[model samples]
Target: MASEAAAQMNFQTMEHPAPMPIDQRTQVLLTPGFGTQFTDHMVSIEWSDTRGWHNGVIGPRHPIQLDPAAAVLHYAQEIFEGLKAYRHPDGTAALFRPEANAKRFNDSARRMAMPELPEEMFLEAIRLLVEKDNGWIPEEEGSSLYLRPFMFASEAFLGVRPAKRYKFLVIASPAGNYFKSGAPAVSIWVSSDYTRAAPGGTGAAKCGGNYAASLVPQAEAIERGHDQVVFLDAAERKWIEELGGMNLFFVFDDGRVLTPALTGTILPGITRNSLITLLREEGLTVEEGRYSLEQWREDATTGKLVETFACGTAAVVTAVGRVSGHDGEFTIGTGGPGQLTQKMKDRLTGIQRGLVADSHGWVKKLG
Candidate 1:
């Protein structure tokens, strides 16, 4: 099997002879902001249509050389994934729900007309990088090693078709809290002008274009003094979609949880999925269906919607304190982090940090 061959593939590692000194590395780990500090090494793998995957290498982190006519430069045939490696209480490293990331990466590849990597190879690549960069895992309370695995077309051709060659690489950074506001919760700006994705588009794919398309609206939100932007559906521009980089969830006063359904225009978020499971475990009703901006405003005004939050790999679960739109602005439940929001964050972080029992076997321990 192709996957079997990839599993047997040996990675030649060339450790950095002159890595960052202990003192500097320690200082970086102390206050390393999100995606600002890097580890010493990375993983690289090459693939071609003729030979399949080969040349697995784990080498010192450095710049990548690309030809001027590289397909990715022109066509943007690329996909990426984000995950984290946690430092357990016993000093061991673990990954939370890595298999899910692997699956999503392949799904994105499929949608982009790129080659689908073997799931085993994806998992192995992550393991190799984390093992070699073991010292980079920060021990800070809310800090971890952020892993970014990405693949891009490498063929130096200008044609608008799938490239014959590709490269996959995994890099890591030690990250702390994502938000620097230090507020109890975050504020969102509803974008009535721009939409994130449209039907039968690349909305479900974890590719770069989706995020690229959201930058303008995000800038508008920032200009308006909001923390993030929440986009509406492209078709009608009335249905509630998601945030610029995260998924949304609404908590009602009657113990009901609702999130925007995935209708080929929403990214199926892993954190959102996990929280749905956790909410069900707590005997709460969870619904994934169409929700409109009008309904959101009405609920918030009538005190029916008690809390709202956004979830992603970087931010985990962040409470949406208030929402501002073209018409006006309103607050959600005291304009601060709600009780259910804190509970979900605590339970999830507890499982991740090994402070609680792993009932679902979501934690994969690494050496």
Candidate 2:
């Protein structure tokens, strides 16, 4: 059954008068670097206390008009989600676990004290945008149409309470490789000074503020010549939490794997969950519990930890070849993509591209 929000709203399409030329679009698609290139159209839905969700639109991408004193600008009430629309082998597009992304978006909305968008409406919004801009879906390997769905408080007010009005939008970007360096494996810098989230905080939420707080440390990592930053627990400042925007997984030499438990401080990642399911199906024991930075260093030094990788919607599965912090630096395995890491990436990407059977029913084909 369709939710009230979905049933009450109908997306009105507004075609672009002067869309990008086909040759230019094709050139951009050939080398769409990350989020640099956008599609012709986007999806939007407005919400208010009185109107609920109405005025859904699929129109040309344009700048938004937000009041200077909007609630989002003042109180930082914003949430967003990231997923991909992959072009399958047979010239069809499919989304991987979009329902999961919708659920997580609502979870972030709840944590941020915003209105929950109905799952039906959320999925429909993405579908409308993806279908409208299907040409923007990249055909090359390691490229796809990256979808960003976000909601922000739009009510113009200067108060601490939740806003009465909101705007939800979905945008598409033709993305190639996430890491521009083209390194076989990424190097991570440990953030000793700053922590991402603590217990009873918004660490688990996919809000803009959480990411806003991480920019400084992320910049520091870049300055130190690393690809990404990893944060520890805010309370103890020892237990490994996650990266700036990804989840961590440690593979052991004894055919066991471990990831930091979801203790209300780590974002429950869809890719992380999918990888766990895949690992378990391969008859490997995957544990989720507290893993300290000290333990990571010790295990890598003693060869107990053979591989470490980060997972997220954008990067998928990237091996952590090297780790560095204020204390020192250490290499994981051979300081390159591990055998299992490559295997996992191949299997996951294979399923995503429809080359392998999606036994888990995760692929939602949109023809």
Best by lDDT: 2
Q: In model 2, which residue pairs have backbone atoms overlapping below 3 Å?
A: none
The TM-scores, one per candidate, come to 0.99, 0.99
What is each predicted model's overall lDDT from 0 to 1? Answer: 0.93, 0.94
lDDT of 2 by residue, 70-188 (tens): 99998999999999999998999999999999999999999999999999999999999889999899999999999999999999988789999999999999999999998999999
Per-residue CA lDDT of model 1 for 240-338, tens digit only, reads 999998999999999999999999999999889999999899999999998999999999999999999999999999999989998999999899999
Candidate 1, 190: how far from true, in Å? 0.7
* Whole-structure CA lDDT of model 2: 0.94
What lDDT would candidate 1 get against the real structure?
0.93
* Candidate 1 TM-score over all chains jointly: 0.99
TM-score of 2: 0.99
